[model samples]
Target: MAEVDLSVQRYSAEVIAHRHAHHQLVLPVEGALSLSVGGRELRAAGLSGVLVPGEARHAFAAPDPNRFLVIDVPLAAAESLGAAPWIERAAGGPIALDGAAALLVRAAAVELDAGGSAALRRQWAGLLVLTLAERAARAPGREPAKLGRALRYIEEHAHEPLTVAEVAARAELSPGHLHHLFRAVLGTTVQERVAELRLARATELLSRTDLGIAEIALRCGYADQSCLTRSLRRRHGVTPAALRRAARAARPAGPGRGGG
Candidate 1:
């Protein structure tokens, strides 16, 4: 526990519970994860991340072709988060980070995979934990349990043709209640949230991976590359190609690639 441990990992579909002496941050780099932290069921995907306190019981499962950035932080650095509402506060996630948190995890992954140093890894992990804690503290009130449930359903299914009715049913709420919940709690409509999720994922894939636009479109649930292009342009005012190019340019040149 002298250092924060960081790695990209995947899990089998079979559920398994893990309890560790160290706190853990489970964020998706590519796909979704169904996990429970201390009896609170949640899902982690692009912007939806899980923060597990030290010694808490957490179990998870995910589909194939998925990757997650798992950070194991020593309890000392993470102790400040021990008393937050792990269940309720996680509702608006996907926790209220917008798209930046997911991108940050991807950046950390690059350095980690290349065997970067411990100091940098600790900084990345600390920033992530601090953000999660701060947001939870800033949340207005106890998050409606149904809202959290609806968010989980959406994170797991937003890539498909989604409907408010479907999401409401999954959360065991009426469509009207779901609508009101989104407006009251999140201040956005269900469709908009789903769209935000899709586009956020599209942005991550375009900027991080070398995958083709069409494939990225499919993964993000767009009808085609053009649809994804339209959404990206409308929301972020950029094209997929331009996003990719900028990401590549901003990335630091890798070692062993230039003159020694």
Candidate 2:
């Protein structure tokens, strides 16, 4: 996936119009903002915002100087949210953020503004995406069973060698069915989820262990060191060796060390 740019923008009462190279999320922190995009007029009041697709012509206006968080994410990032019919229908609509979502957006904006590293930005973006996904699932007339099950499975067996067939069986659905569900509910596949889990475990191992790359790979369910390297590079754009070196440098000098 491509990198996303997150920033906080304060808009005055006047109308602002522009097109972006990537999809944009305009989340209002205070007051209300109205957006016009592709002939659709949407209003976001309280804790809410609008999502505009890449290269889509859009305009916004606020009743006063309103504070908002602007997230410019790749189109692929929006796929997860777009899985919900309501979200799809509300494509150019303002999504109401509630307290949790509002807090997450605020934190994301702060982290982006702090000039954090790429890794931190990626972590924060994941959080923000998750928050939005939860809100999208709770929208009126949305079903939660499939999404609930998938999330539960990912959390419970993140350490195991997870596969699409296995997770689909857990949900009592076919692999194809699960694929559709994941695309609709999470904007990614079961394979991606498992890779994410493995990569997360790899990070922990790198920081806290004396284990070699091959050992870590075996523990994380990769067939071998090469497999682990491929998955990690695909997911994080970094190799295990580099990550291990960085983690080692960051660790304090100590006698006791471990891996989980």
Candidate 3:
């Protein structure tokens, strides 16, 4: 059986710098913890954690009560981590655990506490390794880094009059290259994505706010009410007014709806 160690730990103070002979994964469940790796500090909060490769010098500190799950995998089993072992550790960086990784880590933690069989531990450990390998392959510093930048730009600037050329310049790629990456990685063209984002925003306004269609159109990057109506009809098979009416009808009759 391979060497794999899993434990749930709580810390209130600082842990002296240390090096592990085996790779370690730390998953934060409650509170927050600070990890120091490669002369940098990483804040693991919410559902975020850190993966420190075997033989790497690292330390952890918890100003407040902190709880986390730590798993150790032998150097041989950690071959899947590839050449780069230490992930980026900026305080607010995107180095946190992905959804699949978080789920696997939590499941492994549960199995460890249940005193499961050795075979079960091996299986969970193997899965965890594979998931981490996938994350490492798509790490932000890799080939798709610019694509990630473009995605962030879209999410942040979708409400503006954004064009493919403008977004490509922001992402440091030519317009054609940006379009290619969008289609290849996201399976959608740049304009399609922007329009979809705008429509999504419009739907949110229609459902949550009483904003008029003309104002919502301006806010969602459409030229006017007609533009918004045309796009909504194309994408949702209904005009904005009709969609808003449907949304209003679907909402349950609240207590305020009672006749006095």
Best by TM-score: 1
Candidate 2: list runs displaced more than 4 Å.
79-89, 138-260
Deviation in Å, model 1, residue 143 alpha carbon:
4.4
Better of 2 and 3 by TM-score: 3
Task: List TM-scores for all candidates, in order.
Answer: 0.59, 0.47, 0.49
Q: lDDT score of model 1? A: 0.70
What local lDDT score does residue 49 receive in model 1, on the 0 to 100 scale? 75
Residue by residue across 1-260, what tens digits does model 3's lDDT show?
34665666666564667786666767665455677876766655543456676677877777554456666777655544442343332112323343445566677777777887767766776666556555445434543667656765775688898889888888898999888776654456778777766776687677656888999999989988899999888866998888888877865443111000
Model 3: number of clashes?
0
- Residue 97 accuracy (lDDT) in model 2: 50
lDDT of 3: 0.64
Q: What lDDT tens digits, residue by residue, belong to model 1 across residues 25-144?
A: 777776667788777777776667776767777777764346677777665545444523442344223354445555678888888889878787777776766655554454344435
- Report clash pairs, candidate 1: 47-94, 48-94, 93-96
Local distance difference test, each candidate: 0.70, 0.64, 0.64
Q: Which stretches of candidate 1 lie over 4 Å from their true place?
A: 1-4, 12-16, 36-41, 80-96, 143-150, 153-192, 200-229, 232-260
Clashes of each: 3, 1, 0
lDDT for 172 in candidate 2 is 74
